[model samples]
Target: MVEMTGIVDVAARAGVSVATVSRALRGLPGVSDATREQIRQIAAELGYVASPSAAALPTGRTGAVAVVSPVATTGWYFNAVCEGAQEVLAANGFDVLRYDLSEVETNRRRVFDTQLLRKRVDALLLTSLPLTPEEVEALHAMNRPVMVVGPIVSGLPSVRIDDVEVGRMATEHLVGLGHREIAFAGGDPDDQLGFPVSPDRRIGYAEVLREVGVEPDPALTVPAKFTVEAGVAAFAELWARDVRPTALFAASDEVAMGAMHEARRHGVRIPEDLSVVGVDDHDMSWLFGLTTVAQDVRAEGRIAAGTLLEALRSGIAGETTVTTVPTELIVRSSTRPAGQSAS
Candidate 1:
């Protein structure tokens, strides 16, 4: 029978005392981050597993991080962020627990009001989940290290892209192509989920249109969820109008692709009869030849997780840290000059 490698073996391999190994493995104070990482690596190499009950006795930390999101992990953006954060947390001997509160209202309330107070996780990562002032206060009252991804929450560190700028860039691209009548396909500003992204993008789009001397038309703006089916319905509504827009700016690539598919189904050639642009260079954007403003969702998640880990290591809750991810517009065959021939 093979014997299990013990902490003494990990300490010997890591060139550290067994006491120090115990401290590092337990995630207790008094150990440098570098030394802790080295000891962890050595322990992993030697097939050493610390007893959970023993480890928790000294540190009172579960060594698990909780990620809270408003939506399920099925979407590309949500999945990418979770994957990136999980990679970093797993590397540091920490497990990730995801709380997806998208499906049921009772589940969302239970998580925020009662479940979080049980102190199950060492830290919290909130992604695009809108919080009421009361909920934010409740989260702060927990006294756990908290980091946010997406919208800015007061008294919390956050990593997100400038959504308004993303909207402006998408609109400007179509405007630069001499498109005068442009339509926007996005979600409602005051959605039930409380995501402010759609509203921020709408502001950017309107600002750009006014700057270019084009009067923004309320009739041309269509509200829809950030999905392909919603985009199809939104585009259909816009198409049925007496004055169809020559260009379309979708809030997400999935929406843009859907609009394109619907347009083609109605015999409207892309970039010929109409031009299209979108935000979020989604996984299938290339397959559909979508032009979009691209933001790194995975990087945002990784950075948010890294920030929380740093706070846990340093034990400093100094000032709230805010990191902004940048976006870029990628032009493709999906867009062209207004009234130009589609090559």
Candidate 2:
């Protein structure tokens, strides 16, 4: 093995600034791939490896980040965001401490305390969970760089898509197809985490209906969890009501798929008896031919992680910049013009 050397010695041999060497070695952004590769080769030859504790000594940081989200392993949106953020954080020589939350009130409330997080991480990333006023106070008291990946919160940076507009787009697609009879399938508004995704989308759906002189009908709205089974149950709600809406705007692809499954069981032909659209072009959406509003969810995760890194580096945790990602309507076999029968 070559003579064991310190980071400074590696920086000296790399012909790059210490920051560049640090970033390159840690796989952080801002360094060219070529530069990173060269730095790695030089460090390897010099027997250099990053020491987590030694690096954090200068900044008094723990070199770790806390990511608090509703179970990161489930929910395509939450899972994808976690993966993206983890990729960035882990690559940057930072340990990711994930705290999975459940709908249980106590479990959700425990996150806001931050009693344990203060001693652990240099920054925090909260994904898709809305904070109560008191909880917001706790974050301020923590006084660390924080990033949110959902609806806007006062005095915090966030990365999210316009969920309200997402609803509008899906509703408009069905409404524009000349189907005045419409239904909405969304998540329960009383979710313990208070995530605004579904409610905002429902607002958009309602706004579009009113704009077209179609009064929003309470009887047509079905609220459930964001899952395939929930969607099936939502379809059952409609079936029981005997409501024959020509079009349905499901809050998510999973829900749309579930509803479609139930619809098929009842001998309803897709785009013939009903036209359906959903949000989030789920990985399996194409297989089911469900049209949907697609958003770059993984990109949202990456951006949120990058924003946190920037915030940590800049030392300005109170930055309230809300980054909005765009969404688009992807038409597929699930929808056709109203009154157009399949030949």
Candidate 3:
């Protein structure tokens, strides 16, 4: 068994003073690079793990970041966020503590309201979870820095793409392809969360449809949870209608995959009989040859983590910086002229 020791052990082994060892280990930049590397090497050779809590007693900094997310098991978006957050946090000598949000209302309330997270983590990275006004107030009241990744909420530092623009871009892409009869597949506007992003995306779809002289048809718009199954089911209902849309603009890649699967099952050719476009550029999009509007989910996560770390270092919380990253359209085989089916 390896003996557990404190900074004194590392300092003694490194043959440096305790204060010099402290600065080198904490990643403070004043020490010479050579000295820092030597101290780090000695510490690693001894398998020494610094206790952020112990350090915090003196410095008031934990050197640990917490991630509060809705679900970690599902969603490529969340996975990307985790990946980016992990990369950045590791690079900066901070540890990451992830808490999978319990979906049960009571559990969620307890998780958010209780001191379960307080005084344990130095900063927080909130990924794609919509915070209510009260919740926002609770986090702000903590007096610790927070960086939200996805959806700009009031009184929080955040990084997000223009979701409305994503929708508009998808619609405009189809419009440019000479598609007028475009359909939108997404979730209910009045979601349990009551956030307006879904509806805003739907609005963008309708706006582009109107700009190009096509009246919005309630029949062509389908609502489903953001999933592949929902996509398939929504498209099924839309296709069953007497007059089907020539093209579809799904709010997410999972939805697009579902729609494509059902279309293929029904022997409907893609881009020939029905063109499709989606958002998020999910990994499987390439395998399915899906044309999609691409957002930097991983980059957003990395930036969010960076922002939180910066806020933590600056000792400022609730600074409320709104960062909007850009998006792009990746042309693929899923879209073509409206009447031209997949070849």
Candidate 4:
């Protein structure tokens, strides 16, 4: 038997008309729910892979999008975002291709310049990866729409929290409880990209310090990678210092947990001896009774997907807009007034 290669084949297998098949495949209006499902199932069973050139020849779309992250498998943030984007994209008849670049320049160039990126995807969803000036320009030049989660690129529609504000918010929460000497626990500010996050968050911490008439002390600032071990190491290093902070504003929940562990080892008490606050409300934050600023990663992901869909349907590309998600302080048993020491 011979195989058919166009809308006719899909329609034949789905028991629908060519027009109905087109509508279902393109996610256009005027198709019944049952018809859409039938068409999709038929397409899948037939092993029918749409050629980008062929698909675009008629509809000018590849029916797919690229989701590029420093790492899509990032603890919670990236995973939630990818889930949200996939939910929306798949529902709209667009498939997702995930790529984890992890900040390797060589891998990045290969992903961008090779067949992996060659017109296979109609758009891109960038999650928390800092694209160099040239990279941003290159995506712009490709003329594909790009939606980002966390921080903004020069000309990309992005969904992000005001990370500086997030940092400040966490700090102010602690300061309101009368924490005078506070320290930051995270990666080195001078490191590459520092992702802009480390520094922006630190600024918020500094702002609160200055607001409370406390001069910024470099000695109080601690640096570590965004990992549990890094957090542990940073806290241990700070513990060795003659002047330990009465409070800590950890960059992430993982860091916060590390600090809590080290504090316990040194016979320091939580909320009693030290007040702690962190960002990301990570999975273990609650388990450890950690206070944190919670941003809905899942909701951010869903909204990003919606924004990208709007752009795709409206034929808009390269419109860089910032969407800020709010953060909430979840007060718990981990913080208290400075004078309370359990050591």
Candidate 5:
């Protein structure tokens, strides 16, 4: 009996997974152009024949949009955006399938390394994710419309606020009010998830600080994930510093509220001992009288979804359009001029 050369041999020779070999041979979108060509050549050389099951591509519309997040998708912003998007997509007779990696490597690989990203949705909506060059190529090859929220990518349609402007606006408000030593607590400064929101805002804040001759202090920035508890921890980190900031610019209202909560515990008074500001005029921002740079989060989601729907209707499958939303600074009692008592 002669051993037969199979798809496995082709995949091994091509240094790709069996699934990738199948996708490349079947003319699916997940495989990049270069990789697909390489796989084809290798398969032909090996005389590999794909079974009918392996070659068949699914037909018709999925009636769904994929909402992918590089990290966890349980934050207030994520929820609000999805709610707005769902309201629009549901009304339009489509479903939203979410794939949140929760910052886990396995989940991330599973979503990106397989057909999960390419086959299951008519369109894709990414939340603050920046992809690799290969990933971008794969997306382009798939030929589906892709939209992003909270980050900008070349050739990709996105709906997000001008994050740099949001940061500059927040920082300028604090600076204008005579608060010099402003601390920031928001997304990770390292930005391991590779989203533009944090970095762009960081740039804005730094620019504002530089214009006023105040250097941005690395000690004052904290990676407070967008949550109240994370905010509390981040504020504690800031309070522990030898030269604490008199004013804090939290990236979100939840962080501001949590920081405020922690401030009270340490006998530091809001606006009196330490002025604070945040982005995202969350519902609770009003309850806490928290001043924030407010972006219409739900409306952003709606706009993102609506754009994807338009692409579906028009058979447009590229990430070329960008819809920018407006952001407003809402003043409340949480921030005030740094008083003499503040140190």
Candidate 6:
């Protein structure tokens, strides 16, 4: 039998006190982020297994769930999902520990490599984060229940919508309105977190165009940061082109709102001059009269949280299941037939 690494060994390797190591490993507030990370790295290298008694409560569990999100909780989708998840978790007597990584490589690495392994959370809820194979394996090695809220990662249970189908619905709506010269405004395909939705949506858009015998125009596709400001700038670039599109398909409602604002600034009429469609029926979609493909993001979060809770109660780990949320196209007054005059 091999020897197990002890806390003192980890403390010695990391050049920190045993108490400091304890604080760091438990994710307490006393230790600095850098020091905590170093201690965790050393513990992993030393193959330290935290004593179950070190993290156990009177109830025999931490009673906390870690919710990992790649971005801040400002966006509508993120905020709604978090709200829904929090509601369910809180009702079930579990506290949520939110870890917003800002889609930074170092932050993501630290969370996956060290913080998660600290055994502070009973389960993990990953929201819209694309994990590498190694990261997934690390989570598996933890032997704790894990749930995903967006984009399926192989061998993990997830709750999400068919992003490709979402893109197709948006594009099909534009095509049905007699739009031939159409543009796409969406998130960068190469974002730091490796999010697959942006690229998947782009693929769906291109596929629809090809099916209709229309060659997808590379020049009309613009990558942005999935924010209203980014959408405005992207639309400006498209407007600068000599051959402007008659309609645009924004990847999200915020982007569509930005495009509409930009068009208004340029004295361009909506529907008459340029029709705009987007995904996600944002709160302001009705105010802007924007057409969009809508999904219940908050409901997805609730379901994801519930799923994790179920797995935890059953004491089963690594049982893969997939739950797909549905989406629908909501047609407002934003889109009209191509070449139609303003009423």
The candidate maximizing TM-score is 3
After superposing all C-alphas onto the true structure, candidate 2 shows an RMSD in angstroms of: 5.5
Q: What does the lDDT come to for candidate 2?
A: 0.86
Candidate 5 per-residue lDDT, tens place, 1-343, comes to: 5867778898899999988998899787988999999999998888887543333344546778888776564477777777788889999978788888786768767766537666677787877776776767677776777787877887778898998999999999999999888998888655544766766787899999999998998997888867788789988887787657889988778888899999889888888888888888986789998999999988988999999899888886645877889999999988888755634
- Best-fitting candidate, measured by lDDT? 2
Candidates 4 and 6: which is better by TM-score?
A: 4
TM-score against native, each model: 0.85, 0.83, 0.88, 0.84, 0.77, 0.79
Q: What is the C-alpha RMSD of each candidate to the true structure, in Å?
A: 4.4, 5.5, 3.0, 4.2, 13.1, 12.1
Off by over 4 Å in 3: 8-47, 341-343
Name the TM-score of candidate 6.
0.79
What tens digits encode model 4's per-residue C-alpha lDDT throughout 184-256? 8876544665376767888998998899999978888889756677778888989787667889998888788
Model 2 segments more than 4 A misplaced: 1-50, 54-58, 103-110, 192-194
Query: Model 6: per-residue lDDT, tens digit, 1-343?
Result: 5787889899888888998998898788999999999998988888887765555754357888888887683477777788889999999978888888885877788778745544678888988887888888888877788889888888789998888999899899989988888998887756655777777788888889998999999899988766788779878888887558999999888888888998889878898899999887988799999999998888998998998898888887746888989999999999998889557
In model 6, pairs of residues that clash are: none
Task: List model 3 lDDT by residue over 1-343, tens digit each.
Answer: 6567888999988888989988998788899999999998998888887776787897767788888787554578787887899899999988898877756566468647636566777888888786778888888676678888877777787898888888899999999999988888996544666665567788888888888888989988889667888899888988798556789999889899999889878877887888899998987799989999998888988988888888776765646778999999998999997656535
Question: Which 10 consecutive residues of model 1 have the lowest summed lDDT?
Answer: 110-119
Misplaced by over 4 Å in model 4 are 1-60
**Which clashing pairs does model 3 show?**
270-342, 272-340, 272-341, 272-342, 273-341
Q: Name every residue pair that clashes in candidate 1.
A: none
Show the lowest summed lDDT stretch of 10 residues, model 6.
Answer: 51-60
Return whichever of 4 and 6 wins on lDDT: 6
User: Residue 291 of candidate 4: its Cα lDDT?
Assistant: 95
Tens digits of per-residue lDDT for model 2 on 113-141?
77767767888888877677778788878
Candidate 5, residue 194: how far the Cα is off, in Å: 3.6
Model 5: pairs clashing at backbone N, Cα or C within 3 Å: 155-319, 156-319, 157-319
